[model samples]
Target: MALNYDEIVGKFDKYIFNTYTRQPVAIKKACGAVVTDVNGKEYIDCVAGIAVNNVGHCHPAVVEAIKRQAEQLIHVSNLYYTEQQALLAEQLVNLTEMDRVFFCNSGAEAVEGALKLARKATGKKEFIAAEHAFHGRTRGALSVTHKEKYRKPFEPLAPAVFVPYDDADAIREAITEDTAGVILEAIQGEAGVIIPSDGYMKEVREICDETGTLLIVDEVQTGFGRTGKWFAREHSGIKPDIMTLAKAMGGGFPMGAMLAREDVAANFGRGDHASTFGGNALSCAAALANIEVIKKEKLVARSNEFGAYLMKKLKNLNKDYVKEIRGKGLMVGMELSIKCEDIVGKARERGVLLNCTSDSTLRFVPPLSITKEQLDRTVEVLDGI
Candidate 1:
């Protein structure tokens, strides 16, 4: 028998927290860049679970890894060591300049870990973050996030100073003896895919160095080859003292991590911080497969090539409603003078799924495995809208 969609919706309304203004459709299954609703209508997915499905939905290798690992082991907790966890940590350390890693279960947890490390390492009580930046919803993370609407309801957050994004001088001015570190997203995904100016990251690195402040880069949404690189900081030619990662790390499973320089990471003692389910056998195995797929498939280069194609095609449309098109790799955004919520609904009706962030920016974060033909179809639908 078919599932009762209305009954399920009613149950959700009755029991689930009213947090998200959910889309009308109910997704039942997904493959590659396409998702099917309960009624069997298919749509090209451009959100990619908000950049979590970097290897694409239900990737065979990741699925196999999960199944195999599940059959053998799932969670042993942080009380014991697992080879899967150690291997994943080694891979991350080798991929970047960081020397140590801390496993967590979500982007917020990773950010929270990084913040705690910063405070402990620097012995400072304050932090500096960028305006229009989003870290996470946890208390420590929320203290650094810039949006007033999200921060207002929960006032008197942890002490943090805000600086204008992409402005090196403002960061320098904001730093003080009490400031523990400076945290910002390399590419602000929630702020509508906002890309920083050239040399901005490098300048921030220099400022942090001069002021004895740790530089923390949040790559939760822009990592795992989503930006055509292992991490977006590569594009800026700078290595942060610490990096927060999640979203796509576990290839659809829940996982997160914080990589830090050796000296700074040593600030955390054995009992300082930990998670019960973090670095479990299953999530680590899935993450390993996800990284392998990105490497074997060479999806990083593909993201760059196809992303340029997408931007070029979107520019050619020359739609009057579009004010600007910007992004790197598969993380593209179309900013409009008018609100884009209606455009998102219209595009969904036309069999394309798009996300509108910040009210007027239409965000597109398609899977790295998406084909050019699929992109062409998306553009054709947008043209009609």
Candidate 2:
């Protein structure tokens, strides 16, 4: 006899780490933008696995590559090189202006590696980050994350100062000779799709240039075509010294990369930094397929077009609860006059999935491959809500 879904969830509750407050639904399978729970309930997945499934769930290209690679090779230590890793690295370098790449297993690891490189390269300790920013959950990443609720228990985070986002004057005041880098998210995903003002990124670039401090952009959520462009920074017309990537890079498999200039990456030497499973052949193959699909399908352009349509439809809803709607490309947020969790629950019940950010903002980061017709259905659900 097979185990029932409730029994499986009960086992998970007893055995798994007690860190995350997971939703009650037991998702069993997913295709395109729809997810089915163990109980056979279907849902429209507007959250897109927290922006990880930019190309949609179980995309054929990514799945095929993974199947082929699994037969050829699965795991390899850093001692030996493989063609998949090389190809993926080349694709990442060509996709971005950064010189070299370092592969890791998760967004937090990428953030950790970037922080180490920045501090070692500049020989400084202190750093500056934005208020309401979330880099990752690692100790080093958390140190730069500014939420007191998240940081209070974990005292003595890495020495860093928090400054108001999109405020150039505040950023200038926060920086000093001791500051090694200025780390930020091009768009604050966890803080509710908070986009900085126009030219805000350019101003930060100029400031970093003047201060001789490395500029690190945490694109873990915004990278890999989530923001229409290949990268959110491309929209700003500014270049970062080091860019951290993860989330959608592996198309579901766990992977992350830090893109840095050649000179800065040389600080790691041979053994200074390493991940046992970084750039493993299987993940690299999946990532290569993922990037190819993004390019071949022009899903980035579709995200831009469909996202604009979605935003327009949402704006027309114009309910008194809506305080503001802000975003770029497919990364969008809606601020409400009241708490958004109730609305999120309502949307979920109506088969339109979404999540709230920091209490008041509703976040939408759907798959780039999502169709306009599907978005129309989502809007219909929203209208009823």
Candidate 3:
């Protein structure tokens, strides 16, 4: 039987929480860089599951890996080990040059783990995060996340100080003896893809070193070739004490990880932190295959190449309302003088799915596998709008 969009929506309205402001279209299926709605209308997915499907949606390799693993060992408690877990951990370490990893289930969970690890490792209570930074929504993650609306109701979160992003001086001033770590996103996703200055991260790293504070890079959205490099940290040439990963890590499968230097990771001894489903056989298999697909397709280099192409096309639009176009690699944002919510609707009508961030910036985080022709179509839709 065919899915009825109205029925699905009615069920959601009756049973689901009224939390998200979701797009009107109901996606039924996706392949590569396109998603088909229940009505069979296809949209070139510029959103790419909000930058999760980096290897493109439903990659055959990832699907096969998940299916094979599920048949044998879908899961087992963390008390025991699995080959899938071991292999995925080694691969994550190799890719990021991090010493150890703790797996979880989502970006927020990864942030929770990273924050916990930082506090435990440093034996401090306060964290320094940037203004406009969107770390996560959990209490611990929210304590560091900087948004009045999201934080107002959930007051009295864990101790944290908000500083101006990309401002090393402000960070230096904000740090105190109680500061356990400084958390930042290499490219601010929810704050409209705000990319820091070239030396910003390097400067922050030096400051953390001088102050003996842990530097935690939240790469939840920027990791896995989203920013051209395997990780956005590569662009800065700095190694953080702790890092968080998710979104694209499992090629759409739910998975997250908190990685750290060996010295910092050691602080999280047995019984310190654990996720029941973290690093389970199924998720690990999916992640291992996801990494393999990223390597085999050379998607990292492709992202760099195609991101330039998309940026050039967007630049040629020549609209006075355009405020700024900035990003690294595939994680690009077009900030507008006016709110872009309506523009997202317009693009959707024209068969190109778009997402507006921070209310005014149209974020373009397409799959690394998106074709140049599809990119042209997406830009053309914007031109028409």
- Flag the better candidate by lDDT, 2 or 3: 3
User: In the order shown, what is each candidate's alpha-carbon RMSD?
Assistant: 0.8, 1.1, 0.7
Better of 2 and 3 by TM-score: 3
Clashes of each: 0, 0, 0
Pairs clashing in candidate 3? none
lDDT order, best first, reads 3, 1, 2
The digit string of per-residue lDDT tens for model 2 on 328-371 reads 88898989999988888888887878988889998889888887
Better of 1 and 2 by TM-score: 1
What candidate 2 gets wrong by more than 4 Å, as runs, is: none
Taking all chains together, each candidate's TM-score versus the true structure is 0.99, 0.98, 0.99
Candidate 3 global TM-score:
0.99
Residue-level lDDT tens digits of model 3 in 1-385: 7659998899899999999999999999999999999999999999999899999999999999999999999989799989999999999999999999999999999999998998898899999999999988999999999999999999999999999998999999999999999999988999999989999999999999999999999999999999999999999999999999999999999999999999999999899998999999999999999999999999999999999999999999989999999888899999999999999999999999999999999999999999999999999999999
User: Least lDDT summed over 10 consecutive residues: which range in candidate 3?
Assistant: 1-10
Superposition error at 309 for model 2 (Å): 0.5
Off by over 4 Å in 1: none
Model 1: lDDT to the true structure? 0.94
